[model samples]
Target chain A: MENDGMQNGNENGRESAQSLAASPLEVHDLTVSYNRRPVLWDIDFTVPEGKLIAVVGPNGAGKSTLIKAAMGLIPSASGYVRFFGRDLSESRQRVAYVPQRTTVDWDFPTDALDVVLMGRYGRLRLFQRPRRADVEAAHQALQKVGMEQFANRQISQLSGGQQQRVFLARALAQDAELYLMDEPFAGVDAATEAAIVELLRQMRASGKTVIVVHHDLQTVQDYFDWVLLLNMRLIAFGPMETTFTNELLQKTYGGRLSLLTEVADLMRHEQRKERDPL
Target chain B: MSESQLLDFFLLRQYNIRVVVLGTVLLGIGSAAIGCFAFLRKRSLVGDAVAHAALPGVAVAFMLTGTKNPAVFLVGAAIAGWLSMVAMDAIVRRSKIREDAAIGIVLSVFFGLGILLLTRIQKSGAADQAGLDKFLFGQAASLVTADVMVFGAVSLGLVVGLALLHKEFKTISFNSDFAHSIGLPVRGLELAMTTMLVLAVVVGIQAVGVVLMAAMLITPAAAARYWTDRLTVMILLASIFGAIAGYSGALVSYLAPRMPTGPWIVTAGTLIFLISLLAAPRRGMVARGLRNRRNSRKTLEENILKTLYQLGEEQGGMFNLRTASDVARRRRIPESQALRGLGLLRRSGFVEQANNGWKLTQEGETQGRRVTRLHRLWEVYLTEQVSIAPDHVHDDAESIEHVLTPELELQLEALLNRPTSDPHQRAIPYH
Candidate 1:
């Protein structure tokens, strides 16, 4: 039974890969707008397998927007995304996302273990509690982040770096193939930064694809194997050795496109006009 | 009712009173259990909006059906509550109007409409409208067995739903973004939560009415939160608190003349919340105050022991006793605080009183030495690594000495190369 299962999985994988692009994440002409204001413009990229990819850009360059759109948190204006040559819904169990820590209220009445157990929520059906195996996985995930001692600590009682580690542990409990993290190292201490980098390398070594929205450009070349430079639009994407040049970094952060903001404002104005029509 | 009758009622000798109490408690449990989620979501005002918005539904249900049926009122209230939620969402999404403003608008508009309809119905002189105005502030005294059954069944359903969908509810309340990313149907779960809130409000409209119904939902949850960091324990505590408030309301209304059940229930809930705020352990005011006092006492005790040790060190023999006045002269703290600290330390066996003077015991000597070492080591660190002048480091190190852990002390010792003396040239006592 085991042999048949393994063989069937490999055959299915080959069939799916041949049917469509086999990239871990593939986005084509992705456009996302809030109301009528466009944030990301016609982004096109496909991440290679088993690499630590950094999405680097200036502030308001849609770095977080790209991840949110890929996760389908926000509706894309026009585009399609494929994960493992299939839709996100089909390969959802093999995907994990770690949002920015600030996006949630840390004062919520839940502890580290309870928060990590949320990673297993997707695997359970409706009206089902997390199984013993799921709790074990969550505990193991916490240990991996060096937060096992704080397993019962309230989120509000944790320091900033410890809270970030708890969030990473939650994602680790998902045990996914593709990981999308938003600013995982932002505002972290040196120890937390090292731990996160180590975790990312381990994930990459195990053939899991990791994508991060990175802020520090100096560390990008060292931490990421691939780089996708964005500033409201896809500027360049390739292996970090070639694409992370000084000129490209300047293009991404130096003189941003003022036209995108102007057009976004105009689009919002038009949308308002259409709404009232008085 | 007489005191004896009240006693009988409390002892459950009365059947009608028992059912009525059970109904109110069930309603309270349902509302407060879900209210924990609403409270954590920082949407406490939404419950108020939903309750107020439920008023018109009860009125409209009666007007449409011309019967004051409990089921009909619930349906009407549920519909009105649902519409209010939709209206609030639309106002937030479609326009720049914030959610609070939308809730305020919807709550007042729907309640005003319900009042207008009720006034019109009262004037029409409909026979069934005799006690229709009771929905305004609830008439717990008039609740029949049938009405109690309706409230009980709906409240049970809400409790069951909360129990079954706990994981999804907690995830969404804590972080909807993560829930959405994990494919847990974030919007649907939110809608479910609001729907449960609507049902809770609908069930509460009769025994507690619209105005005071929100207290049953919010007060219990708010009080329960101070007692626990775990959501499950919080929910259970909220249920217990709500049930107590509900029982208290039933008792007051039954025994006292002119006391409304709804307001009594709310008053009782407020009392419970106040007690929890003042007396609950860990997060309560009394506990926090005690903890702070204990911490400061330890600091004082440690400082006193260090002072006595330092005085003895300067005299060449560490076992010699020092006068309290001499001990007080070494530190800048108040004399009373030093004496008090010394008294506490002596009682704890860290120090002893001998020949009308104080001396450190062996335990106290070790502790004082550790504190002294940490202080001097920090002074060295400040001057060497932080570039602070030696004289300027003493004041900063004074407060930090007591809080430094043994692990940190080791780290500092390693980092400072086991400094022989502070910048003041005094010996850094080795433990």
Candidate 2:
């Protein structure tokens, strides 16, 4: 019986490797820490290609940390992330990241078009300026998000919804196979939210993968095909039909385990004491 | 001076004058170029702090090297500025102190250290220290040809480097996290930017000095911001402003022969800033103030128009001539204000003289009807849609009536389905 179980495990690992080749994103045993305290621990997941996925969790549940760590924006404590069965550095141009709108200086002196043009920076060789074709591509992206009319307006003058659209236009200009967005719907108008969802569906239909850090629980069933429910650690991740149950949501958002929180607090206290003893 | 001498000076052929002007101009361009990024990052004060921090470095370099070499001072100042930034970062990360407090602490502490070093150097009574005091407030007239050449070359290098890496620098400054996500080495770009800022501060110290160089970095950039919203345009305008400040400051110093160049350059830059603040299109204080005044005046005229329409309606819509005192009483305005309103109305052809009082003209009657219609429509809409008490909405409607355009009036009418009366039973005028 032991021999049979070992053979079954090897076969399953091989099958997963094959699946990883087809999936846009695969993470194994990922852990992220801030100031020596783990925010996300032992996270393992795979995102199916050409599917719209939502990563949902409570505040401080490390939903943003998961995305940032996978994109190498933040250092991970352990494990690695692969894009299409390859390391991120090897597949960078094929991926794009749309950061939260609030993360940047809105008063920056560039217009909508110039910002979208920055999306092409990754493809340009060093010391080479963007050409006319790059400008055309940026204009096309702005048109896609219906922000072409605002192409010349400085970013500071843009309304919140319009600013969010400009950021999405920048992401579209990247023309990548995989897209990751953090809170694209937060603080946007209802119309902008609808436009973003429509754009995501279109991208999925075109065989592009999109992952979003979504905060609205009410719209999860309507907006996403797959869901990853997380609260500091992976609670459940699968197709929304099989997962996304009330029981799993309760586990993810229900108050943290008293014992687990107590342990975390104690560990943090010990680490602080070790760093600077009184 | 002879005409030929004047011509020579204008042509920039004189060695001393040319060197001073060229050096100062180059310094201006480089500082302003780098300053654009610093200002956008909201780190304008960092330049001031770094400049002040350079003082102790200059003193220490003099003490260690036993010479007054500009190169030594440059290296020393760069190190000091870079160290202050590192310390500030550490304080912010390791302690609970916020960024503003950290910067404030670093600025004052470093500046205090610099003052102490300067006093110590003065006490030592070194022979070469005669000109070192000039660094406190620069003397552009004292810049030698060699210094001019070095400054010019470095300025060119700084500008060229920035131009070559414009996209990368812009990306990092606007959004570092996004840049990192795209594998752009944000940390490395930041280090390079900081280094460039330090270099800018260092080169500017000779002409603007540690005390006033910060102004050169920030004032021109700020002034340019008022003129244009584009970063490229703002940088170019700032460079032009800086060059003007430098040239005129140098010229004045040359003419006076005793005044320092640093304060004058800063003063000139401040003058440009003042002009931009008061006169720049769209964003200037004067333009905004004018727009507001015109709007308020128009509101007052429309309110008067509505009052006249109400009086005419009370007397069967004939607009019979009413006395000034009566108009004032009905409108609850002072007699003087009523007379002024009447005079303005006559100028605009909205009212005409009739015996002892003013009466609305045909055009005036039309406008009066529009204003009264707007006031009543707003009152009705506020009471119906916003759920305001009928009595409480008059004040809001009074203000809204003057500001609502024709399109808004149409929309309100459509929404309310052309209500004939307000909740208070006042007739809603229609055109």
Candidate 3:
């Protein structure tokens, strides 16, 4: 705690550090820019432990950038991220990330079991290979996601849902205290979505924090206990019942977003008619 | 050449030939091994640019050292090759120009400069520079023991580095974002991959030259991809392919007098690729064509069977004989197509010719019933579960019925509650 306070440098930041030390993740004055344009502006929040949280926003709203910037995968224009009030580098082992499914080439020459084996690589020393114990642990992780039978199956041959499950299995093998998943539910089948939700619940029961970049607005209340409404800025952040109100949702997705959706839909309709000559 | 000459060439009996062959073989093994990483990284053309860039360095190194030393060539080539890689990446990152254009620009500019320097050096009449042009197409026959040692050590170092860092390499190549999040030095690992690629190209440009060095990097790796789906196995197979091409090319040059070994090496690699493209199992063009033919044949035969079964049902009998034209009319296909299908079924003992017409055997009746049953099940599922219009279900179910497996059939049955009739009021047979 003393080290965390000193790193914060100012009395105000030190006060917040001491208060946020009990939380799993805290972001203070976070702003992320891409190509000299700020994608996320002045984001600030501290998340509690053992809660399933969702970050929801419209297209081009910097949802993924927040997660990447917080994990130090992308440089932030301003502000910093802390896990348990410590720098990300100091507590990286306690945090895990599942990137969007499209970020990787699924057609890579590897199998499900081998992809899962990557989860254990962080614990291995430099130039060391995965051992028998690591292999056994990887198997257990796959079994937890109901993918033990497809362990030897090549990744490209797996269906969309199965590929998502393999990704989840890889994250499960990390065995971390806090998980950051980017759109894990996108393009997955009903069964895979259900399995992921069940796994998230189990993780919550064990006092592990899970933050998801959720896309489906219809199931936000049903899937997560906490909601962080964002659209290039923090609109609201609190318990799902209190913060997930229509006013905040409207504030996040108001005006330009709805008009944009309408124009896109109109263009799609016109294109379909043009294709069929109707 | 006679058989003994061939044997003598392969057995390494000739000292000069042995040195050249060892150098080329090691060149192949090293380039192809590291080439797998480059292939997966989609940086195959970077090798070409690097190799082309090395020529200028070789000409400069000779001018500075005033020697034809192989060690100096390697140092010069490696530096220039590494520089080309840096330049290509910097242009791609800092400008609007695409990677392909950057590679093209770097490759041609560097190669053009090398040729300019080479002409200038030749005009000066440096007697030791007589064979400097061999670096363009390579002089495999002129490899001395020192040259062989230099090439062999560098090539082997590339292979050893690949083996030692395979894990980190795989993680970074497959998913660098995830690797970065997990605390792996992704930027450093990328530099390592790039360095190995440059080293492989620079070491190989001596034997394969700048023009054909990319083949050593791309051909064996492409052929290996069709043979396996595992990275380690692909690397192993690619190295073996490269080694075969290496020695075979050297042997061809030895026997054919005046033929260049580098081109022959690439030719041997292309031959292997052609064989893999046509003959490898599962992914090969020939195998896919064969499977497609078998599938269409099965589909035609089953459709004919179903036609016969339906005609029998109209007549209230299972084994009534029907003419080929009658079968064709019922199925709305040509008579010849129906006859061919019946002929194929007769060969398989599913049908018999008797009384100037064809009749199904007992086994054929059971098979026909199953196809009909699958069609009806799919129709029912489409209409009852999917809520599609009843009339639209037949065309959709027709194609799907042929490919549905027994497990899917059982699931469809369970999902649809084992209905006795489809949406069109056709009975779904159960066995």
Please provide TM-scores computed only on chain A for all of the candidate models, following their numbering: 0.91, 0.93, 0.87
From the highest lDDT down, the ranking of the candidates is 1, 3, 2
DockQ per model, Cα: 0.72, 0.61, 0.67
Off by over 4 Å in 1: A1-20, A273-278, B256-258, B308-330, B349-362, B379-396, B415-427
**Clashing residue pairs in candidate 1 (N, C-alpha, C atoms within 3 angstroms):** none
**Would you list the rank order by TM-score, best first?**
3, 1, 2
Clashes of each: 0, 0, 0
Off by over 4 Å in 2: A1-18, A256-263, B1-13, B256-258, B305-346, B349-431
User: Once model 2 is optimally superposed onto the true structure by TM-score, how far is the C-alpha of residue A67 displaced, in angstroms?
Assistant: 2.7
TM-score of chain B of 1: 0.90
User: Chain B, TM-score, each prediction?
Assistant: 0.90, 0.92, 0.95
Once model 1 is optimally superposed onto the true structure by TM-score, how far is the C-alpha of residue B123 displaced, in angstroms? 4.0
RMSD of each: 5.2, 4.5, 6.2
Instruction: Write candidate 2's Cα lDDT for A138-226 as tens digits.
Output: 99999988889999999999989999999999899889999999999999987799989989988998999999999999999999988
Cα lDDT of candidate 3 equals 0.86
Candidate ranking (DockQ, best to worst): 1, 3, 2
User: After superposition, which runs of candidate 3 have C-alpha atoms over 4 Å from their true positions?
Assistant: A1-16, A256-278, B256-258
- The lDDT values for all models are 0.87, 0.85, 0.86
Per-residue lDDT over A1-278 for candidate 3, one digit per residue giving the tens place of the 0 to 100 score: 32233222233454666665767898888988665456777777777789999999888788999999999988998987899878988887889999999888988999999999999888887789899999998999999899999999999999999999899889888888999999999999888999999999999999999999999999999999988888887777778877788888888888645553454456556765765686
The native-contact fraction of candidate 1 is 0.84
The 10-residue segment of model 3 chain A with minimum total lDDT is: A1-10
TM-score of each: 0.91, 0.88, 0.92
